[model samples]
Target: MMQLENLQPYAIVEDGPFLRIIFDHSYISLLVDEKSYQFIPAESSEIFINKELNKVHNLFDVFTFEKGEEILHVTVIDLMHMKQFRTQLQQIIHTFYEKRTMIPVAEVETIVQELEKENILRLIDRAIDEGEEHSFLELTNRLSEYGGKVEE
Candidate 1:
């Protein structure tokens, strides 16, 4: 029962080949070299220094993406991490709701102005609907940095 207001924003960390998204004691770490990921969910509201602590009963794996040559792997995540990451993704999507807060007014107008724009907007919308939280935030952050008004 954690709210975005209650949880701290996730921070991305560089650990050699791994990119660790950390929030207090919990983390979702991505391995750049292997195109793999390892996540360690938080123990509780109480802080712990051990990154591998698992309070949940079973360790689970969720397959995210696979292409002919491209691959991504996510390994070792507890249920709590999944739940919290889901919430965080929801919050990010809410910010980019169809009401159009984060996307610039000019950008919106431009999209509407073109008759055949290939509808990147629709693709983005679909991504919001079907995409995982980590990927969603990563894309949103990049868009924000490029031009969109994604929350900081």
Candidate 2:
């Protein structure tokens, strides 16, 4: 089991139509919470690089604008080239986290204040996870038993 601590943080960026991800080491797998993503090599890059590498001749890298239906994949990149172009996303993530620590007290307070607004979202997600398994009456009754107001 890996804690979020086990994985370095990264920021994904795009330039024109190309998406690049830089990671500490060559290890990276894109995902959303539990789902994992695989890499889709660019068609042009694939066709051009086929003479140099055999694996990417016909693979289609997926792109879409849908929720919960996103593709997850492992992307192998030339570390040297991407490093010359941009820092590894993992390094960028680490740097972002690092910069936050140097923030002044007032800025930290502002960040925390904004984070509190996200707590409601967490509560709603919790309700959804638990709501599916229990009847409305049962859940409402349980909530009342625990001194919480419930509304349908």
Candidate 3:
């Protein structure tokens, strides 16, 4: 199957109440409305173009034309759809950054547990130096709970 890529728009002209999208061989005339849209294929008598337009569910949709084995795809998008897409893209980027900067609760809890273990070790050392039996036993118990061993 033959396919064409990067088909640039030739021109967009306002013809009466309709907007015309001009390509190299064919053109599409659109009568846009707030509630619905009317797409009319002009400058070409290919029935496939009309069939493709009939398949369009939205105002901004892709139309495909097939002549024998060679197929051409055309994208039709209005300015309003472009702006809406831009806004949606911006929102996606913003949400991505926001989630990236946020620290997970599990990670924060792990960090706090590590710091608590370090503090317990320091207190145990202080207890050993001062010869405090009660404090040394309590700190060693806490260290054992944290999966750390205190040498007797």
Model 1 quality (TM-score): 0.23
lDDT of 1 by residue, 1-152 (tens): 21112334254333443323334422333434444333334232222112233122223534222323554434335324566545653453344343443678899887765532334334456677886667666656655443554333
Strongest candidate by lDDT = 3
Q: Write the per-residue lDDT of candidate 2 for residues 66-148, one digit (tens) a residue.
A: 12456433223332224421244345444554675586989987776556535434554566777753454455554554445
Off by over 4 Å in 2: 1-102, 132-152
Clash pairs, model 2 backbone: 22-89, 37-72, 37-73, 38-72, 38-73, 38-74, 39-73, 40-61
List clashing residue pairs in candidate 1: none
Per-prediction backbone clash count: 0, 8, 0
lDDT of each: 0.41, 0.38, 0.50
lDDT tens digits by residue: candidate 3, 48-141: 1122232212344555444445444445433224544334334433454476579999999999999999999999999999999999999999
Off by over 4 Å in 1: 1-6, 10-20, 25-101, 116-152
**Judged by lDDT against the true structure, how good is candidate 2?**
0.38
In order of appearance, the predictions have TM-scores of: 0.23, 0.19, 0.37
